[model samples]
Target chain A: MSLQPLACIIPPDLLAAVAREADATQRQALLDTLQLDQSFRVVRAENAARTVETTRALTPRVGAGTPSRSIYDQKHSTATTPGTLARSEGQAPVADVSVNQAYDNFGYTYKLYWDIFHRDSIDDQGLPIEGLVHFGANYDNAFWDGAGHMFFGDGDGQMLTDTTKGIDVVGHELTHGVTQHEANLTYSGQSGALNESVSDVFGSLVKQYHLGQDVATADWLIGADIVGPQLAPALRSMKAPGTANHYDNQPATMDGYVHTTSDNGGVHTNSGIPNHAFYVIATTIGGNAWEAAGQIWYDTLVDPRLRPNATFSKFAALTLRSARTRYGASSNEAAAVKTGWDEVKVRVR
Target chain B: MNLPGSTGDPSGLPDPAHPRDMSDAGLHVTYRRSGGIAGLDLVAECAGSDLPQDHARVARDLLDAPADEPGRGGTEREAAVVPAGADRFTYTVHITDGTRHRTLTWSEGAVPSAAEPLLASLGGLATPQRAP
Candidate 1:
């Protein structure tokens, strides 16, 4: 809920994907802007530090639903923020789904921490859930800066909706902080991709639990709500990784056509392989996603063995090892874990 | 966000053997289908569109294409409900922030009748000079 305290280290690809196919010069300009944005992020962090010094507010809370209390919504663009005068403690917004969606997403994510994980908000220090719904000029995607905050982009409306439409997205973005706090996975190549996959795994589990949807009903896709109706429906699909989204001029394969450009070495696209792996593991386990499958992935995410830029194969091995370690070597969960990885074309020793 | 069917490229071909009307490569229509439905990959050559992209336009339209939709067949889910070739269809908006290229597809239809108002609230895509 406070200002940015950490780095806004998004691999250039996310920004690249945001600016796919831009001309060479324009692309470079955008990249420069991104770098500038990062520097600006530093400035924002300094500001947050100043605010903390002035207010000394450690616990983030909501006053009125309309006027979002989280620092994330300051200077927000949508009517969703409602822009209330200030936090009015316990006041609900009557204007839009934006406020309610923020309220619910924050509540669900907070509960996941407090109950399931026994942690607090994104920071694990009861950090306020700074949520900015409808971010950017109809942008798509949600992000959690190292600084204790979250922002959601309203989809262009064809494939995606508001990035905040899904609880898992919020959880996924917030968990990015968790990953940074724990593994600090470098934002590119295999490790960065693994970092992204971990967030997807945890994010999906959060959605599954909140919706009470069993693995059977849950659709395994990231940013399911962000895509426009005309384009691909899935930003990423798990059951069929490459099957997510393919349209006119968009290549669906991962090896070559998938994004492997500069920014963080395509963490988002490479993550598909692992996301598919997790889907298989949960399906093979034949129960709730948060059960053994969730436990195994969660353990690996926090395991000291996980290293930055660890390739998909390495992480797969780690999951296999973690599952065996967490739930006895002979456990069905472990077998399912192995099978899941195998199905994803990941073979372990 | 009504997952309209009219949004995606309408000429997605399942059978390449069938020669498509290949006058324009850019306007070749494609469609996002439903999960249970089988897709048709038609060899569609686009025709009709002839516009060149500028630096600013490319940057804005780069990510203009829609992100992947959920529940399968991309934009086809929304297309299924609309009358064939209905005005309610999928459209692609290529935007360039003068830096990165983004393609966004515009699809409108049956997101969930309840979502009509919300979709409108999200607003339409920015108009830009299309790439020739």
Candidate 2:
């Protein structure tokens, strides 16, 4: 099956909302974002034909899991050519806010994987983190193009600010890189939903880790900052699915599971099912989310048994097994894992 | 005999949500495309009478062309390849001439390249409306 590279932080539904509310100029920018996304998708499909080794080739192993970072200035253009390197691994802060934010966020993402997962960069191959900021004129999205590059857009300044403003957004896009390397989940149906959910989980985890907030303290909002003020409250709420908008209406369980051909079988919407599940697991374990609950979910992700086309229940089962394996079957961690799926109405068996 | 997964009868084929059959002549077509993360649409309307001689000829030819089966066609395939992480805009082409009317919607990448000029003209006319 043909797979598409994971693309963009802002959900299309919200962008649609923005487009609806926007003036002509802003509306054009929204449409341009949609067009850019399509162009990137095409580029990813073309890139897939390249040899695996060529695409996955590791960067020179940075000694000791230290991040190898490269920040580029797109200068309000959509081109991917990292316009004049603004900063490198050991460089000082740049004058541009977008450049600096991109640099710092890449470091934070690298730190999360290294400190918590004992993994290096995206591929765990000590890959260099590459970021392109200020892409397009008021571009309204960010994406990781299956390859090792991340691109951020300057929002329309009303519903969205700068794509780099959300650290979780950075974590979210980079985790797509991680998922691409590991499971390479098929980007459609249930498997696609799993791919999106995994990114959101780790994205939230990275933010929580950076803020030193446990499950109770963390906001648990995915793209809250990036969505701006006037639009819906948050992008996606793990604690409360479908709270983004009445139209979002993401069900937290199989009972409300959406079966549609759009959004890769409602990957963003149905993801609420698993997102709510993870939230329950973390809240129940009741400490730093990245510790017990986070570890279980991460373990489940890298588990050998997990298939690329895994359904929601299939993923839930893997988490349960990971919990049982890491912390005995009767342990609170394992029980919490079960309750997480149970609350979302996803069968763990 | 219709079998599961069989690519047999055209009617038996799984049609897209809103399928349009433009077999009738003298119909006007309005094409709206929505896909990608923005979930915004590019809305364009074209009528036989509104177009100049050359553009009108192409519009008539395109409208008269055989429509694909109900499932996502060219544009949907292009957009759907990535799955649901983003909104792959679906294209809805509604054709009416006051008598008979039909509506068809498809995702990006599934839209035919031939529809490019037609959509461009309409998109040029469109002001980037939000998807309903």
Candidate 3:
């Protein structure tokens, strides 16, 4: 079936806060973003219903191929849909920092999935990657439309900088597309939180894999490079949830799980629980995160048992099963997986 | 966003849970807009004696709008599966006039065309901008 088209890096609550709290000048932009987001949601949903379904079979593209990337420029206007083409794969570097960053970071994201997971492009079919930069006037978010496109905004200088600056942010958005092609997790409650957490996990993995950083060395911060000077030091910290400067609502364990009815059931906030689990596993495994820890998560993401409406406990159980299957049940990898979930208070049984 | 998972029955009967009758017992209306980019809540109230006359008058005018009709004109079929970070807003207009309590919910990025006037009147009252 066709996947839903609803993904944005910056949570709705954050944008809502800016809209409600920002000065008149800033409030208008955030308001416009909200409108823009609704418009896109409608478009994606319609497109998905009509678009052809692609099965997740890990099959390579027809002509044994390479990465295909295209970058566009919106010129600070939301009127045009994908904007003007700025850069493409195998092309020379462009003058715009956002364009180059999107191109380069997207390349790394593609590399992480290809080299590490041995998966093809987004669709495992050499699907072309596209990005639109400077999407709106001081737009403070980035997103991947389920239709295979990444849109980055020049953040409002006060709360956020250029979204393209964050590699993990791009990775996070792309991984949403990955989840779409795979489990197609429902976008609400725990399933929605799992969808969000999956993106964060792979997003960090993309950064780690690109930088050659091991789990111990990785910062474990999702949007460290994108947050503006005035806001939090980072969006959310996997290693330490509430440590991020201004955005301190995230709870590292189940005890702190938020039960609000916003942010699609607090998908962004509750994601910290699973994020910490992944961090614990990777650090305890003590090596490149992509090796064992990341692999286990990846396997779980692509596993058939991962249903559309998976809960944290269900997902944790799947990871344990994947770990045991990949490594022996008594292997340290399996025990580390259990320990990771246990620390997060997600009973795997 | 108001009545999440409320199944559409196709029949014309109103949902029993959503009692449409406004209680003449006393008007108490509360408007809560949740789901901005930050997912912060904006709450505004117009109750028996607590609200100032000026705000109460505004609330009276807002309640004059049809309570039964959805604020946004059309239902977005795509919203059923919208993922987190979609950056849209969800608004809950809670009306409690004495024994009669009714809540109407709508979600979107832009203010509903019909509810703009109501939201505009309440925006300043509920979501006061930080004093810069």
- List each model's interface RMSD: 16.6, 11.9, 9.4
**Least well predicted 10-residue stretch by lDDT in candidate 2 chain A:** A49-58
lDDT per residue for candidate 2 within A219-240, as digits (tens), equals: 8887777875543566678898
TM for candidate 1 is 0.55
Tens digit per residue, CA lDDT, model 3, A312-345:
9999999998887777566799899999999999
Per lDDT, what order, best first? 3, 2, 1
What are the runs in model 2 whose C-alpha is more than 4 Å off? A1-62, B1-80, B83-132
Taking the candidates in order, what DockQ does each have? Answer: 0.04, 0.05, 0.05
Better of 1 and 2 by TM-score: 2
Q: Give the per-residue lDDT of model 1 (tens digit) for B1-132.
A: 333221222333322332333332343121122110001111211221211122122222323434453311223222222221111123332233334433333323223343232122122211211011
- Candidate 1: residue A207 Cα off by (Å): 1.3
Ranking by DockQ: 3, 2, 1
Output the number of the DockQ-best candidate.
3
Among the numbered candidates, top lDDT falls to: 3
How well does candidate 1 reproduce the true complex, by DockQ? 0.04
* TM-score per candidate: 0.55, 0.70, 0.70
Predicted candidate 2 versus true structure: per-residue lDDT over B1-132, tens digit per residue: 110110112232223532333443465867664433332334666565543444444455544455553342433334345532232334556666666555544443344555544444454444344223
TM-score of chain B, candidate 2?
0.53
